[model samples]
Target chain A: MRRAFSRRRKPWFAIAVTVAFFGMLYLPIVVVALFSLNSQKSLTVFKGFSLRWYRAFFADHDLIGSLGFSLRISAVAMIGSIVLGVALALGIVRSRGKLGSAAGLVLLIPLITPEIVTGVASAMLFKGVGLPLSSGTVMLAEVTFSISYVTVILRSRVAALNPEVEEAAMDLGCSRFQAVRLVTLPALLPAILASAILIFAMVFDDFVLAYFTTGVTPQPLPVRIYSAIRFGVQPTINAVGTLMLIGSIALIGLALLVPRLFGRRESLSQLL
Target chain B: MSETSAVRLDGITKSFGSSVAVDDVTLDIRPGEFFAMLGPSGCGKTTSLRMIAGFADPDSGSVLLGGEDVTYLPPNKRNVNTVFQSYAVFEHLSVADNVAFGLKRRGVPRDERRERVGRMLDLVQLTGMANRRPRTLSGGQRQRVALARALVNRPKVLLLDEPLAALDLKLRRQMQVELKQIQREVGVTFVFVTHDQDEALTMSDRLAVMNGGRVAQVGTPEDVYERPADAFVAGFIGTSNVMTGTYADGRLTLPGGVSLPVPSRLGLAAGSRVGAAVRPEKIWLSDFEDGMVQIRGTLRETVYSGATTTYLVEIAPGVQLSVLEQNIDRSRREERWTGGEIIDLAWKPEHCLLLCETA
Candidate 1:
């Protein structure tokens, strides 16, 4: 009886390690959340809870402009990358022999290369091309860097689709393009919507690429937040962080819910 | 009735890399006839169907539909639809929407399309499930959806690539009867492809037996079964007890040094090698009729299936003949013979078939 009980004992060490890992990861965010509601200006102490910093965040025109700019950039980047990434994924999956394999390998380069390298390279390319550094440049750079991620998420999905389904469409009196537009696109809707939401959230919170490519006037939100932190620590920054965190969590929930809306009971993880 | 051929393949040949998937072959399918292309896997039956459906282009020859050449046309331009082996139902579309897909592509009016789709759903017996998704349906229900989706288009011909190959045995048997009835009602020439010989024999009006990328025979089910063209056709269509022997004057000498009288063929020379095939059910064990060829042998084994019983008789040292008898009026199971008993086997002379080629 004792041996059986010992064999079935709870793993205290593993439980403690898991709890400590989660605590270490979330303690700083918890602190930011705690101080964002603190009503005082001090970072080390929490006073009575209030919404003053959130109100201050709404009142600052510079930060609001940056927020709007980041949102527009994310929207544009998400659309651009999804279109190009889906096309690239289709090409890579359908093209036969060496060219398809080579393109598949080349698509992985952006995903594996360090983000700092990609940021520096994009900044240099824009400057070399004599293009002005602005929100447009940031949007273009983010689209370029994010295409590989979208393809990674969507390529497996496209490949798993039955080729006969497309053939069936053509057999039913649809032209090649109509077959792709009506049948193939609808079949890939869940994955496409999932990847779109993911890319939107990723591009919104991205910092390094936005920093290297933004113009001087209304920079992206992450870049604007970095500048504010350098100047002085403000509780409103914690409020902005909390808002972005909530937005990301919302995007993830939307991703998990999109497939169910399409009558597929797939989770967000399976969509990718 | 139209006098034109429904589909005609003129010496079409296709190759993938170094292997020839389909050799030079020509066939003619009559109007409104249920034609089957029967062969084992990789015997070019599906490839030929693809060529006819315009999914594949023949390397050397042309494909003609209703006496018009459509050799280089794309599948969209051809007046034919295929029910894929996988069924390939659109998971996102409702049953009615799936049936209305081709009609909508052709700019069919909304009211007419809805009426036609409704009628088609009724024909496939999925009348009330119009608004349901394909993922909610069972395997047999999905198969009906695929059939309705293709038949609703009213194509000149319909191609089915083993559509019932995924179903269980019970469902497959039921669908076979329903498919035949639906073909009669629709009156469209169905170019069905399947490897199961039983399916080909029972469903098709005429079938083409293919072997090694070539058409070995094309005939009605009765003609093919009664008079097989070669050893391969004989063995493929059903189980035939094929025995090879040397032929002499009105007799064949087996390898075991026994001689059996065989009908003489004018084309076979003396002392030529030949193969003889007899179906298991043709050989009788007792109560033989007059003028029947009788051979004595020792019963080596008895196999009792539910409907019929088979007895293996060793005629010579190594030669064995199988005799099948229906177990219908006789319920006394203990009265049947066991092994090591001498039994006289008799079969009509015409029931034995002589073949010049081996599979």
Candidate 2:
């Protein structure tokens, strides 16, 4: 009877699909989070709740080393991309020509191209330049790839800025450069911080790019987890995954909340 | 406050990609005087203000400030500040910091800057709210902040580009009066740009009416409103009854064969086309005085809006004349003229202007 009525109301027809979508999305994460507290290390067995895997995750030195390396790369990459991207966004927005628009469009290619293709291309570029694949290479590649995301997020904000503020600055007393430094950059601070949070979250647990660009010994945490999974699944991997999930969630929440703290309306631009 | 000209635009012309924004126009603004540039949108008023501010460079001519040519100087190099129509207050800074921005750039002592900023905030009446960001203030409050910010520097000249356009009508009127008081207190040269004729007429010591990238006339508000040079000026500054007729032997003959004597001192050639202009209020209904041009017409409509009654009189089959009369309670409920009644219109000959060609 509910199905019969659902055929008449279109929104009712979407209920089952919506439920299944959320169920598929969160069920695995919930299971992983639930099993990270299990006592035994079996894959399918229901066990009483314990913190043995969490303890094992804390005790592993290699995992801890990889986590630290990934955190450093994420921090460096976040700052690097933001600086370059803000400059690029400002330049692109102010430049007026066909060439400028063409450059703006070209900068968006990385976002549309498959991640695997970018990973393979970066690996090949490092090889061609005679640079060995190391944690430094991963940071360089991550920063290079993440710059487009920052520019894409920031360009609209730069374009939307009121040009009169700068003119007023100059009219008051400041020179042209001083106007930009004092007025324009300060107005764009909220968007810049929002983009930084998103970039940190994206670079922290990124797998495919880091896998291709990282060193042989001390890989990023996602690469480390992939390697450990291939050898044999450890309950410690579940604990690591749960921790990364929580961290990413916190970062995403911060990104969405910062713009609103500045009285901005809700927008998809808050996300990557 | 010297007698010399504070700002001058000598033969200024500006063009953008084949469209002329300001033609070869010349204007001189008096020192410490509140001068207004009045025009419709895209009539080069704002462009003229921007040129004076050094934000825009003219293709020809020069901008002079206090007898010095500063045409090529940038805004920071010049001693002029503008309050934009958008009220472009710095969102990141507090009200006091925003007001002190110019003093800081000029390297004033920190204590002096604070005292000056405090005084300006008091002048604009936002002293207690100095610590709040501009974004948190209301629209009227933000406008005051922008005003205080520009005036704190005490620039030699202040340019306001439709600064009150963003506020509500009541707030805008309030700002206009307060701005006049502030301008007097500071004694700085004010160059105001607006499309509102009332604002220009009320606040300006003198004004220039512009159209199509050219100055139509430059005069006092009363002079422009009373003695317009041409048809456009007469119609633009106020509502007027302008009728085209043929001039022959000191008399203009209308299409309906009603000939009224033109002022011969105008010196127009015989048999030349001319326009006779008169303001609505200048025409009376019951005076019948000597040397007055008298005519009769049937009333077509009557508009009573509490204070005044406007009567549309049809002088001919298709030619209508607008006559205005004050409603000073004549106890004429039955005697007041209604529609379809013949009425006499009378005005002095000097009030009936015979306009010749004027660009």
Candidate 3:
């Protein structure tokens, strides 16, 4: 009786549900991937396999410039958010009293607030302050939006760290700043790297904020693709989307792998 | 206390909100002495140790090291180091790098740093594991790493906050001996803190038994154990059977109307309530001698441990005393007295400690 209850039996219903779930999620992506390699410009039919759209995408200097623009924005936002985010995490975890707790609760607003709301508010703030809408504004908006992601991921890591380790560093002859540099930062590096990768991917794929805050010439890739799609559904858009999907997948993979490189086995779910 | 005391805390007190953590703690830790602060949890032993290491500032009074006041100095500026209870070894750095952290910060030359790190690792028996990350080491080895990391700095005084607390029983015992040996070899005044009475007794040259944010007693292990200062000291350092009763002349009258003769103490009044304590091993079940106080009681229970046996004997209603005996002469072990037998418990007069009750 125990063996019958404990035996391994496949439930066809669960298997079908799982298969349906993944198919629904990935079938559109698979179609885009397949059509990115199409030789003809027909959405409903598959043509002979060719890199025609990819070749066209590479030849378009405007699209290439947007791609480079998005990459630069993501890099800057990643570094900028990480520096501010890690410091905010340490401060929130160490500080006591109402101001610290209020700041902590306020930090979570961006994570839950609608991205479009933040984008509109940021653009209006820049305009109201007599600042022009440009790449700098977009970078600023992206960095502000991405700081919450970095801080949320890093807060628990900071809380889990032994406060005594920092004291031990200080006891070992390092000054306050030196203790953080020598001990606390190294301990948080794994989490920081993981969050940096996450922020990079999020900023790279952002559309609403970049669309609202970007300048006229070199828009972010997602905004450029939106403009190109509004004109006509170019097969080149599919190529760009496919490449971006690959890039983000690689970045997410790096986010999951970096902690293990630091000899920590924490998965991304645990981090978030 | 002498001016050359290695570490001194003069009337230090600390409070967190409404609860006091350490109150009026004044102590003089002599040079090259292995001192221990022994207490149960929340007794302010760790708080006092933190104040000494400059991690926590006292609400009042000053901390002095070699006659130099360090009350306001940060931990880095002070000549002291700590081995945390959790063995807070830096997991990111290599063992050698962790040991050399202080020397590097103090601008020690590279060659001298390497030499000192190598020597410290050897001293802690972690010579071959210098290049390994702390994550790969065992708990005992990690403890040694914490020890070597703190000890390598060669501070005027090394503060250990229950450093062996995370190890297993066998490993803790082994490390206790090893720690004492290392303290002697280095000749640095070690201010050890622990809650285990056995560890404190076995390792400390002098120890302060703390209770409720105050030093209940401070002396050598023998002084604290053999002659505790008061009721709290008597009950904490070892198992003591505290019998509360009223005293008159040279006799104590229990609540059950049974009267027993006790040694007259100077400060004890004729009609005052008092508590009398006697160590378990001091009471004997057989071979009674002259001038020994003997009482007949009914054996309530027998607890046979490996090296010793304890018998719970009820001398009066609601009054029980635990008498401990060595389990020597194994041939007579099985033939010993069983429960519910009438027997005599005897102890010398001086063994009964009297504490005058205030309330």
Those runs of model 2 whose alpha carbons end farther than 4 Å from true positions after fitting are A1-15, A263-272, B265-269, B330-335
Residue B165 lDDT, candidate 1, scale 0-100: 97
Choose the strongest candidate by lDDT.
Answer: 1
lDDT of 2 by residue, B1-359 (tens): 45668999999999988999999989999989999999889899999999999999999999999889999999999999899999889988999999999999999999999999999999999979999988789999999999999999998899999998889999989999999999999999999999999999999999999988999889999988888877778878878887777788888888888888877745667878888888888898885799899988899898877778888987766768897777787622325765799988888988987776522
Query: How many steric overlaps are in each model, in order?
Result: 0, 0, 0
By lDDT, the better pick of 1 and 3 is 1
Model 2: per-residue Cα lDDT over A1-272, one tens digit each:
34445445568557889989999999999999988988999867858999999889889999999999999999999999999999999989999877778879999899999999999999999999999999899999999999998999889889988889999999987888899899998888888898899899999989999998988979899999999999999999999999999999999888778878877664445434
Q: Give the range where candidate 2 chain B is weakest over 10 consecutive residues by summed lDDT.
A: B329-338
User: What is the C-alpha lDDT profile of model 1 across B1-359, one tens digit per residue?
Assistant: 45888999899999999889889989999989999999999999999999999889999989999989999999989999999999989888998899999999999999999999999999999989999999999999999999999999999999999999999999999999999999999999999999999999999999999987889899999888988989999999988888788888778888878888877788688889888888898898777899887888899998888888888888887778888888878633437675898878888999888887744
The alpha-carbon RMSD over the true interface for every model, in angstroms, is 0.7, 0.6, 0.7
The local lDDT score (0 to 100) that residue B194 gets in candidate 2 is 92
> lDDT score of model 3?
0.90
In angstroms, the error of model 1 at A156 is: 1.3
Tens digit of per-residue lDDT, candidate 3, span A1-272: 34456447778788999999999999999999999998899977997899999999999999999999999999999999999999999888899877877888999999888989988998899999999999999999999888888888889999999998999998998888988988999998988888898888989989999988988979899999999999989999999999999999999999888877887878777888
lDDT per residue, candidate 3, B1-359, as tens digits? 43599999999999999999999999999999999999999999999999999889999999999999999899999998899988889999999999998898899999999999999999999989989999999999999999998888899999999888888999999999999999999999999999999999999999999988999889999999888888888888889888878899888888788889887888677888888888999998878899999988899998888888888999888879998888888423536676898988899998988765421
Fnat per candidate, as a fraction, reads: 0.95, 0.92, 0.97
**Model 1's interface RMSD:** 0.7
Candidate 1: deviation at residue A58, Å? 1.9
Could you tell which candidate, 1 or 2, scores higher by lDDT? 1
Candidate 2: count the clashes: 0
Candidates 2 and 3: which is better by lDDT?
Answer: 3
